[model samples]
Target: MSFINYATREIQLKIVYYGCGLCGKTTNLQVIHEMLADESKGKLTSLATNQDRTLFFDFMPLVAEAIKGFSTKFQMYTVPGQVMYNLTRRLVLKGVDGVVFTADSQWDKMEENVESFNNLIENLSLQGDSIDKVPYVIQYNKMDLPSVAPVNYLEFLLNNRGVRHPSIIASAKTGEGVLETLNLVTRLVLNNFIKTQTGRSPAEKKNLVLM
Candidate 1:
């Protein structure tokens, strides 16, 4: 659920970046943090462990109309993708309005990607949210690297669900598809939020369009 502050006139939406270890989640955040305008973003913060790290920050992305005079704010997070950090990942997902599942495109990392994705669905269920209900997007990251799997194979592995999500292909290290991923998820979040807060649902997209 997004937090709405009438006094400050802001609606804060939380979006989490999830993926397998070293699958470019952190790299996505770093590139996005650097890309945002100073006036639009907050300080990037990181909590690190010997093997993994968690990152988060807030930014005002005025990509949508205000809700009852409240501006839109985004609080983004990246959980440690290693299996040992499952607890931390679930904790970060609490009250999340949107998700970005960043999959490593490398052939060798495919198994880890599937495991992390299932872990995601399990954690979401434990928290009373299902991927089918929650708005999310997929990012096939590290596309610039060699030995990457075909998009169709990766989709069959993860996004083959009855309700498929929008997916992007890119190299986060080079800032490709990063903003588009964020924008898509946030749009879904906003539409979902609007539908929840109001009685009507927003118009749906035409097809499984990749942003």
Candidate 2:
């Protein structure tokens, strides 16, 4: 988790980007890092194989403006997408507060996307967390490609698995929907953190919606 200590307030959160190989997880990070104001971000560390390939993980810390007296900090990370890097992927997911699953939209990669998503769920379970309990978002990446899957088809597949997480259509290369996805997941995670820390169960919070 990332921590922020400024005077009387403190906040911490960890968000991880997960997806299949070449699904643009790293590209998302690169774009965010470049887009943030210099004062709002720190050096990005990319630990790669052979110093040229992003084979392990990439970490970047961002300090967002204070919100209602609390400073929010995000420790964003990207997991290696290769199946052989399963151990590395699990390690990066440790202590994650939020997840952004970037799914490749290509028709040929449909099965791979499904498998990788299930793997993420299984890994979360092993870490004592479930997909249903975590603040997660989905990014249907590569939307600019002509051969990409239909957005409705993707949403239907996700909903079939009992996941109601918010999904966004994104093209990392063009900076479309990246910040929107990030903002949505960040808001969800922070709001959930506040509720839980204040001893409010998620179900209780939902019930109060009618009041």
lDDT of each: 0.83, 0.86
How close is every model to the real structure, measured as TM-score? 0.89, 0.89
Model 2 agreement with the true structure over 95-176: per-residue lDDT tens digits? 9999999999999988888889999999999999888878889999999999987989998765466547788999999999
Quote the lDDT for 159 in model 1. Answer: 97
* Model 2 worst lDDT run, 10 consecutive residues: 156-165
Enumerate clash totals for all models, in the order shown: 0, 0
**Model 1 clashing residue pairs (backbone):** none
| Candidate 2 regions with alpha-carbon error over 4 angstroms | 1-8, 201-211
